[model samples]
Target: MIKNSTKVLVLCALALSLFNCSSDDDNDRGNWIERSVFDGVPRSNVVGFVIDELGYMGTGYDGDDYLVDFWQYNIAGDYWVQKADFPGTERSSATGFALDGLGYLGTGYDGVDELTDFWSYNPGSNSWTQKADFLGGVRQAAIGFGISGTGYIGTGYDGDNDRKDFYKYDPTSDTWSELVGFGGEKRRFGTTFTIGDKVYIGTGVSNGLYKTDFWEFDPSTEVFTSKLDLDEEDDYSITRSNAVGFTVDGLGYIVSGYNGGVLNSTWEYDPGTDEWEDITGLEGYSRQDALAFSTGTRAFVLLGRSGSLYLDDNYELFPQEDYDDED
Candidate 1:
């Protein structure tokens, strides 16, 4: 019953409405999505490493006690399965690194003492084997990374003091050799991750003050080069410790940690430009001592405390897009 021109105008109006909805969806595409919650006790200072497409997480301290249960998340299936218990003493503030298809964990604080024993996990057999003791002194809250077939560890609290001494482990020889010390101030509970062949380390508490100094370590030359500091005159830049750092699509990101108070701010670092840019933070409550790992195609943040309450919620970050809900 309508005229031809009237019908044309109605069609155009409908098309415009549909286009606007599509644009809104596109804007939220790269945001964080709630994923499967961790299938273990909620805890802080957890560690995670990726082997192929699967991520392994374990060994942290609940408010009541230290824990050693190990779990693996199948990224493709979006579920978690318990793995072999960590063979070391139940502890917290440990570090885990994946190397040559296996995972190595060591250097944590048991309830009674700081620990130096190290162990390696074999994913194929779901078993762990004792490795040479960490060359560094008994310590906790250290950082570890594997690169080009060798494992490196350094910079943690040795119970008596904060440490900067670095060490490298050659699995082929089952030996750890002390390397040059890290360039930054002696620190504990800092975050570390590798992009390409270089390892980046920064952001921690030392002498009652939180740090923002960032450094990149090249294994080939065994040198540490300073990167742009996280603290800036800009108010948006966040400097905190016990955060998680991971690399995705060749870019590195730091997310969620404590700086006097719990924090949820996120920052992206571009190695090409040696700069950092603040981005939308994660959704939900703020937290510290969380764990992050990349499954090549995606990066995940999971399980940390936010005061008296421990959290088991999990989130997947799309660093290329703005976060879904920013606080």
Candidate 2:
């Protein structure tokens, strides 16, 4: 035979290594555990923000319908409740971010046309108010994030073309300003997240090729630098759109996007080594247009679409990085 014993040894060692690494820093700090996954408005291309321990998800499109309703997820009570509707025209694929306790939402296709209107919500006030427009043209399928009260939005299609332009919004001044280019190829429907002072961008389809290139941008330097590359072979290729990525502390996790159809695979990136690890595929049906954001280390995978139907299923993923107990 081809030495079945040798094969067993190799497989056992590989499994042990994964277990060790997951417990390497485990002093049993018990960081990053999911509390709940709420069933919100079942739709795709939705936008969301995390504010003061509460999470808000809203706005997206279906096959033949668009949406404007909003809902707030209560982490403490493990429940979801309807919130003030988005004041803009009902739409899908809009970008959203939170800054200084205010939730900012803007830009999306409203069935008939893409939009550029911007709006803000204050949970404290239980109301939404209009703000300056996005400055950029109407767009959907872009990513938005905030760093130190400054919001950044860009990288989506504008009508018939894809866009990579980035703009900075200052909520303090209630204004928008252009920033340096993203330094990545122009593509719509990727994923992005802000960690510390830098924002990271990753995989999306453009032209006809699926990309695994990754980059980081510094607000202080106003420049982008290539940092990491994520690649793997699976039933799902990198070819995808409406992907989702979120950050807790400085670690980033990406998952379940669509490539012609829904994708179930997921990946995580660590800036310390500029490396990515393929984690468990999402347990739910493969989907696209699901939006995710994290207040603490825990991340939630909410609703999206699979076959020909919209979904309301929510999944809670725990990135538990418990440090090892030396005792």
Candidate 3:
């Protein structure tokens, strides 16, 4: 029989062990650390592109009005500064990409109608210049990325129908041209992340159905190859739209989006194995329409909305670190 003091000591040891185990379980995978809050109005569906380590974001709808205000984030310094306002009509859900050291933005909804006008930003002068409009007709919630010095935009809603078509923008010629052979289903709010030479595209909704098919686009060969479906694994819960995708240290991640409701779940994809692993999710409110900035070594997610609540908070991901809520 154990004495009361001995029982007390044993109980304390057991409690400590359990506490350590719980903490370990909580932090075994990825972790999110809160960062500096965004300085601009809290908004969602904002467009952004990275140029020389600086992230340029603009033209999103605050709950009350469409916004054309633009801001720049210095990734290394972890701060934001206002830039010249987007010279075009105020809009949200636009797409933007950086090509040849310049950033390009276009094609979104201006609250009343979908827009096709495109514009370019010159960081050197901190100014905006008009470019040829998007050739793919009016669209919003499309995917945009730059590869091998060229920019591509594809998959979104055009007023009445979801579109699967793609178009390439040649900054050298200041023109847009069609690129076919994307056999994926028509979608809107799809997400993409580039890993080395290939860009992976998936997720979105079409006709009220959440899409699961995934594909890889090789800009070098200009071919789309089917990849593992997002639902291939019995435990995979990666089918989400309006999420943000980014690559860090060669691994791709998709985080925070809406399915039937807002989500904070995060998933990491290994292109080499063609598999995804669940990871620690965003530590903030579950949100959709968030934006991500990947500086190759680090990634940050910021400025999205939950239901009617707009968010201006930001968080940086530590893919292999232990979770610490206190930051």
Candidate 4:
């Protein structure tokens, strides 16, 4: 009887160990490591674009005033260097993209009015030159991306109304033209990330509701193909405006945004599978309007607001690693 009781106790202990291991595996699939804090003032609605190995970020609101100070981040060195101030008016909620080795920024709110001015950044000379104004009129919180040496900007709010139109830019001629065909809803503050030749756009709020419809835009075909809804799965919670979207290791990720309130949730997208999997969220404070930089291989999120509080902290995500609170 004594030996039988001892054997039963040992089996119970083994079962308990297995249960704990399973729980940990289920809860921890990704990790976030805090990196160097942003050198700029804490701000939100900043715009950024990655060019080669460096990332350019600028133009945001620090809760008090609009900002124009521009900064360049070296991904390999993990440091930031102040660049020339944005020559445009102080603004926030602008959109930017990099193409043909040059960066372009335009369309934002400048405290008193919406702006349609566009400018291009020449990294070689470290200067910005005004380009043709956006043809879509003055808007803020629009989405922008570069594909095949051309830049595209679309969908945002004018002073009074939200928009769903898209336009393309030609750097050689410095011209803007409308590129219609997007069937998605009108939204501002939506997120987009490019994978290969296709760009995925989704999230953001329209009519005070978080948008769930996802779409893929192919520059070659100039078509907007609908993907799975963000809420396709019963467990998927991937709709939020002001989130940051980026690609790392050929996978797309959206992290930290507002949906009724600030959120720290992270969702990973597989282009081949058209599916989203929940990953470890931002280990830091939940935020919205943050900036994300991806060097094709590495990605990082930084500088945003949590409610009324502005933040300058940065974090890098390791999607396949086990979660560890300690960096």
Candidate 5:
């Protein structure tokens, strides 16, 4: 039988200790913060790119229909503004890359047929102009990356077969030329990111199985080099397709997608050492076919499908910090 005063004092002490522990746990978490929700309808298989200081995302499938409406995001303002609709037919799984301050989007499946029509967007004018068709012909689910002032796109299903051929697009000349094919297996839905002059492409589905082999593309030499395999021996479990990737401060990160099921794991890639290390997964919904865009300082993960649901939320990541979600 303890006195009421003695019991009250013990409870107060316990509360104080818990508060201190909570504060310490928060400090250990990663710098991923939820930003304003995307203004567009919930969607997946979207395309995104950063131009100047702003980011643009559009052209994806919403559960029932293909989407063409485009939206621009102002990072500093934390808001989205709708721009003109994509001039091309409604489509999804399109590939896009930003080069020379302009964004290029092309090659996607449009419900009835795979398409190769290419389009360019100008942020300064908020207008889109059709560009030269992809030399790879009508295809969808390809990968695109920008490096050394040129845009490169390739590899996807062409209604009948998976492809590994690659092409280079010259904005200054408005031309597309064939380049060396990817070194890995023919794949679609792979994740790609460019750091300095090198581009990294990996983790996708081919034939009937998921692929974990990674490749590094050097624009200068126009060659594709294999990196450490994701399935070699280590615990490298960050394998999936329909995922998205972006680079911040020269480091690349791949976020949520589908393997045999919806995936929520996150991974970081180091180009200098050609190594990948697991990071904390996004605290938001686990999804696949999401859109990713990175400015010089920040990276974002947005719109995608989770099972039968479409998501329109956006998450920001500070790669330099540790990720702690338990708190």
Candidate 6:
């Protein structure tokens, strides 16, 4: 029965348990870290999203009016909660995402009209549901991303033109279907993310220059592959358009804003190798139309407008890896 020296000691304990489980999966795939602060109350173009470690901001503009208010940030309790308010129409460069677990807001420019209207926030039912309107450019520095489960909006700038149409939004047939327009130039604000199902978009500003152009959408070959020209890190000054972008753990950040007012710095991109580094010994809150988001890996830069004031703050970025359990 079992006696070849106990089956060679049970095959040497299952080959040392599959070599220590791949040596802890190559020692946990390390190298990826960065952190920053300053996010107390600096409202600009805010509108956030991040379900899981929680991170949800709301409404924007405080230099005068425009701000329906709503907040909640507990990225491990760096704390900030004032949720509920922004149900629909109460604008500021609108656009937020998180389908499935619910959270959608759209278009922007309520400084009058440019709000293609779209709402759906149910942080477990705090309430708000209108959905399916932003088929593209309701206007206001637009640029959205949410792949796979679908929700791709595109380019913005509609006070005098500058938009490249590219809608998707298939909230289980809630509507919106235009895809394939954003080729660049008809711009507005910038930064988008998705990665696996392809979504990319990169630093922006159109007509007057300052665009690190970089497209990549591919909702199953809906096509949009450009890849690079992300202005090669010219250290963004103000090719302005209400900047805001997020993505951690896999790298990609673009904080603060105002090109005409002279950026506040905080750049860092690295789609594995697209590169755009600058973040080193940095700070925070020097914003512009803020409202960034990311899930567990962390990223949040809520509230904006730093030049003439108008903020409510909510910064929380987090990601610092250093693996090598003996690699």
Model 3 spans > 4 angstroms off:
1-16, 38-40
lDDT of 4 by residue, 1-327 (tens): 999999999999999999999876655788988887756579999999989889999999999999999999987888889999999999999999999899999999999999999999999899999999999999999999999978999999998998999999999999999999999999999999999889999998988999999999999989999999999999999999999999988899999999989999999999999999999989889999999999878889999999989999888888989897657
lDDT of each: 0.86, 0.78, 0.92, 0.93, 0.86, 0.68
Error of 5 at 122 (Å): 1.3
Worst 10 residues of 2 by lDDT: 25-34
What is the TM-score of each predicted model, taking all chains together?
A: 0.88, 0.83, 0.95, 0.94, 0.89, 0.34
Clashing pairs for model 5 are: 29-324, 30-322, 30-323, 30-324
User: Pick by lDDT: which candidate is best?
Assistant: 4
Give the C-alpha miss distance for residue 93 in model 3, angstroms: 0.3
**What are the RMSDs of all candidates, in order?**
5.4, 6.7, 1.7, 2.2, 3.8, 17.5
Candidate 6 has an lDDT of: 0.68
> What would the per-residue lDDT of candidate 1 be over residues 1-327, giving only the tens digit for each residue?
469889999999999999988776534324677889846568988777999899999999889989999999998899999999998899988988999999999999888899999999999999999999999979998889999999999998999998888899999999999998567988888888788989999988889888878899999999899887877547645678889998888988889998888988888788899877776677766899988978656999888989978888888888777544442
Instruction: Give the per-residue lDDT digits (tens) of candidate 2, residues 1-327.
Output: 468988998999999999998776334322233345544446888899999988898888766778888999886677888999888899898999988889999998898888999999999988999999997878887778877768888888888888889898988888999887677888888888777777888777778666677889887877899874555434324446678888866788778887767886766677888766665566657888787758756677877888777877776665554422321
lDDT of 5 by residue, 1-327 (tens): 578888999999999999989876654324577888946579999888998778899988998999899999998899989999999999999999898888999999899899999999998888999999999999999999888889999888888899889999999889999997567898889888888778888988997678878898889988889888877657888789988888888888889989888887888888888777777677688999998879857898988989999998888987668665642
lDDT value, candidate 4, whole model: 0.93
Which candidate has the highest TM-score of all?
3
lDDT for each residue of candidate 6 in 1-327, tens digit (9 for 90 to 100): 569989999999999999999876643222323223344555577677777667777787766677777776777757667878986767887777876677787888878788888887888867777876786646877877666688777778777887777788888878888876567766778767665556677676787766756776777878787876756456533235567766776676666666666365666667768766654211344666767667737666655656776655444544354342321
Over 167-245, each residue of candidate 3 has an lDDT whose tens digit, in order, gives 9988888888999989899999999999988999999999888899999999998999999999999999999889999
Model 6 CA deviation exceeding 4 Å by range: 1-3, 26-56, 60-67, 72-77, 81-88, 91-141, 144-154, 157-162, 165-244, 247-268, 271-318, 322-327
Instruction: Evaluate residue 11 in candidate 2 and report its C-alpha lDDT on the 0 to 100 scale.
Output: 93
Candidate 4, 178: how far from true, in Å? 0.5
Count clashes in each candidate, considering only residues at least 3 apart in sequence or on different chains.
0, 9, 0, 0, 4, 15
Model 5 TM: 0.89
Candidate 2, residue 316: Cα displacement in angstroms equals 0.9
Give the candidate order by descending TM-score.
3, 4, 5, 1, 2, 6
